[model samples]
Target: MAVAVKKLKSTSFHGHKEWFTEVNSIGQLHPNLIKLIGYCLEVENQFLVYEFMPKGSLENHLFKRGPQGPQSLSWEIRIKVAIGAARGLCFLHEAKPHAIYLDFKASNILLDAEFNAKISDYGPSKAAAARKYVATGRLTAKNDVYSFGVVLLELLSGRRAIDRKKICTEQILVNWAKPFLGDKKQLFRIMDKNLKGQYPQKGAYTVATLALKCLSTEAKFRPKMAEVLATLEQLVNPKMTHFVI
Candidate 1:
C-alpha cells in the first residue's frame, strides 16, 4: 500500500494548522474520503500523511495524457466515479454540523487502483471554525453541488473547466456544453470523442440533464446531493429506479 505525504512549509504552518486539525477529525472516519493517516507538527515542520491513490486524481485522467499514451475512462467507469464522489459529498453535507466543501473540484478527487473515487481536501474543521469568525459567510452545500456538476461536465465532454487553449465560448467547459445540454441532436457533438460512439445515448443524456440542474444559476434550484446520488444510481443500474428517493 502506498502513502502520500504532504508537507507544509514552515512559513505557512500557522495558516494551515486549523485545516490540518479538521482533516484529522473528519477525513479519517469516512471510507469514501481520503484517509488521513497521521501528521507531524514539530517546531518548524508540518506534514500530513494520507492513504495514497495509485491512479492519482480524476483531473489527471480526464485532462492529461498518460506517459504511454492517451487514455479515456469508459462511460460506465465515469458514472461509477461520479456516484462515488457524490456519495462522499453527501456524507459531508449530512454530517452532524453540516459540513460544506469550499473547494470541490476534479483535482481534489482521487482514484484508487480500481478507479474508486474518493473526495479529498475538504477541511471540515476549517469550515466549522470559519463560521465562528465570519457571521456573513455564505458557504453552503449548494456550492459543492455546483462543483459536482462541473465534474460531471468534465466526465461527459473530456474538457477542463477553464482551458485557455480553446477560444471564446469554448474556453469554458460549461459555456461550451450548455447549449448542447437540452438538444439531443447537438449533445453528441460535445461528448468526449474518445468514447467513439460506444456509450449509451440515453444514459449520457440523463447525466447531462442532471448536470444542467446542478449547474443552475440559482443555488436554490440545484438538486440536493442525495437526489443527485439517487439519479446517478438509476443511471448506472436502471433497476435501481424502484428505490424511493
Candidate 2:
C-alpha cells in the first residue's frame, strides 16, 4: 500500500510540539480518520506518515481550474463523501476526552480509490480558538460544526470557502449561499452547476437546510456531530425523518 509522507519544515515551530501532543491524545481509531502510520522526530525536521489517499482531496474536485478543467463529482459521490467525513467527526466528538477538529475543511477531507472519504490533518484543539472558532478562550465541538457548515456549503455549490478570485458576492461561499438555503425557490441556484441537473431536488433542499443549521451563529444552535451525521444519513435514506435537520 502506498503512503503519504508529510514534511514539517522546522522543529522549532510551535505546531511541531502540538502535533506530538495531538498524536498522543488519540486513543481509539476510526475507519474514516486517516491512520498515522508512524513519525520521525529529528532535531532539524519532523515527518508524519499516513495512508495515501489516491483520489486526493475533496477540495480539488470541488473547485474547477487548471488545463484539464472541471472534474465534476456526481451527486451520489458528494453525499457519500459528506456522510463519511461526518462520521469521522462524530467519532472524534464522542471520544473519551472528546476531540475537536479545529481545522475542518474540504482540503482536509481525503478520498480513497473508491471515493471513500478519510479525514486527515487533525489535532487536539488549541487552548485558544482559531479564526473560524467563535470563542477564543473556550474551544468547543460547536466550532467544528461551524467549519463543517462551511464545507457543506462548498460541497453544495462547488466553490471555495473564501475565493478572492471571484467577484464580490461570489467571493465568500457562506455569505452568498445563506440567503438561498432557506428559500426553496432559490436553493437550486446554489447547487453545484457541474451536477448538470442530475441530482435529486428534495435531497438538495434537505442538505441545504442541514448546512444552514450547522452554520447557526449561536454555538448552542449547532447540532452535535452525531445529530449532523443522522441528518446527512437522511439524504440517501429518505426514510430517516426523526432527526431531519
Per-residue C-alpha lDDT of model 1 across residues 1-245, encoded as one tens digit per residue: 57999897887555556666677778767778998887788856687789999999998988888887667898888998999999899998888777778778989999999999998877655466546644565656788899999999999999999999998879999988998897877898888888777678778889999999999999899999999999998886654322110
For this target, which candidate reaches the highest TM-score against the unseen true structure? 1
Question: Clash number for model 2?
Answer: 0
lDDT of 2 at 69: 89
Off by over 4 Å in 2: 12-28, 64-67, 124-137, 238-245
Candidate 2 residues 1-245, lDDT tens each?
79999987784335556656565446237789887776778757678778889989998888856488888999889999999999998987787656678888999999999999988876554322342353454668888999999998998999888989999988988999999998878887888778887777777888899999999989899899899899888788755333111
Lowest lDDT 10-residue stretch of candidate 1:
236-245
User: Local distance difference test, per candidate?
Assistant: 0.84, 0.81
For all predicted structures, in order, the TM-scores are 0.89, 0.86
| Model 2: pairs clashing at backbone N, Cα or C within 3 Å | none
How many backbone clashes does every candidate have? 0, 0
The C-alpha stretches of model 1 lying farther than 4 A from their native spots are 11-22, 129-134, 238-245
Model 2 quality (TM-score): 0.86
